[model samples]
Target: MAAGHYGLSNLIAIVDHNGLQIDGTNEEVMDLHPLDAKWSSFGWHVLMVDGHDHEALLDAYQEAEKQDRPVVLIANTVKGKGVSYMENQVEWHGKAPSDAELVQALKELGGDPS
Candidate 1:
């Protein structure tokens, strides 16, 4: 709100809303629903996008750049996105991958081990 009042049009906030935490889902850990309304109440121009989609992310940024007020991009995503064993799993939130797991995860993401 203060940012808007001070007229900081260049400020851009991107929130990654991947519901998982080390404890559990964000709802189970601590609910922060109505996120859209929350930022709007703070006088920001809010936009939601699929956090995984590069095109969508780029488009959202472009749209945000046009706003006179500060922009808040709320990107909804999956934790540990590309790995089969880690995707949407809260356990992986703070866990480091084993060597085998790293290989598998990289394979799933189509990245060369070299």
Candidate 2:
């Protein structure tokens, strides 16, 4: 709100809405929380999309750049995204991944072992 009114047209804010905060599920504390609506209500151009999708991310960014006001991209991300056991699991939030899990996660994100 302040940014838009301040004439910061090029400002952009992207938040990873994985519903997993530091302690517990975001829903548990902020039940039925609508990130998009909240930001849009605050006069921000809001975009919602899967954070894991590269194409969607690119498209959203392009669209945001076209907005005259600040844009808040509410990306639906998965905490510990690529790891099987960590995906969408709140326990993984702020927790360090095991060495094995890190290796697997890197591979999943297309990081070559070499």
Candidate 3:
């Protein structure tokens, strides 16, 4: 609100919209649906994009640069993306992976486990 009131066109904020928080899913905790509308109501220029797509993210930044007010990029992404076991599992939020889990996760991502 303050940013919009003061017209902070230079400000750019990025939000990782993974739909999960430390406790649980957003819907299970506090529902903040119509997120774009909420931000727009605050007089911000909102850009929605796939969080995993590098090209889409770059494009969003470029678009934000052309806006005349504060801009926010909402990046839609999956929690623990690419790792099957951890993906969207709330327990993974604050827990560190075990040594074996780390190796498996690395393999799943095609990264060298060494």
Candidate 2, pairs of clashing residues: none
Where in model 2 is the C-alpha error above 4 Å? 107-114
Question: Which model is ahead, 1 or 3, in terms of lDDT?
Answer: 3
**What is the C-alpha lDDT profile of model 1 across 16-73, one tens digit per residue?**
9998777888799888898899898988999999999999999999998999999999
Highest TM-score: which candidate?
3
RMSD of each: 1.1, 2.1, 1.0
lDDT of each: 0.90, 0.81, 0.94
Candidate with the greatest lDDT versus the true structure:
3
User: TM-scores of all models?
Assistant: 0.93, 0.83, 0.94
Tens digits of lDDT, candidate 2, 46-96: 888898899999999899899888898888887876667788787777778
lDDT of 3 by residue, 8-100 (tens): 999998888999988788998999899999999999999999999999999999999999999999999989999999998888888999999
Write the candidate numbers in order of decreasing TM-score.
3, 1, 2
Q: For candidate 2, give the lDDT.
A: 0.81
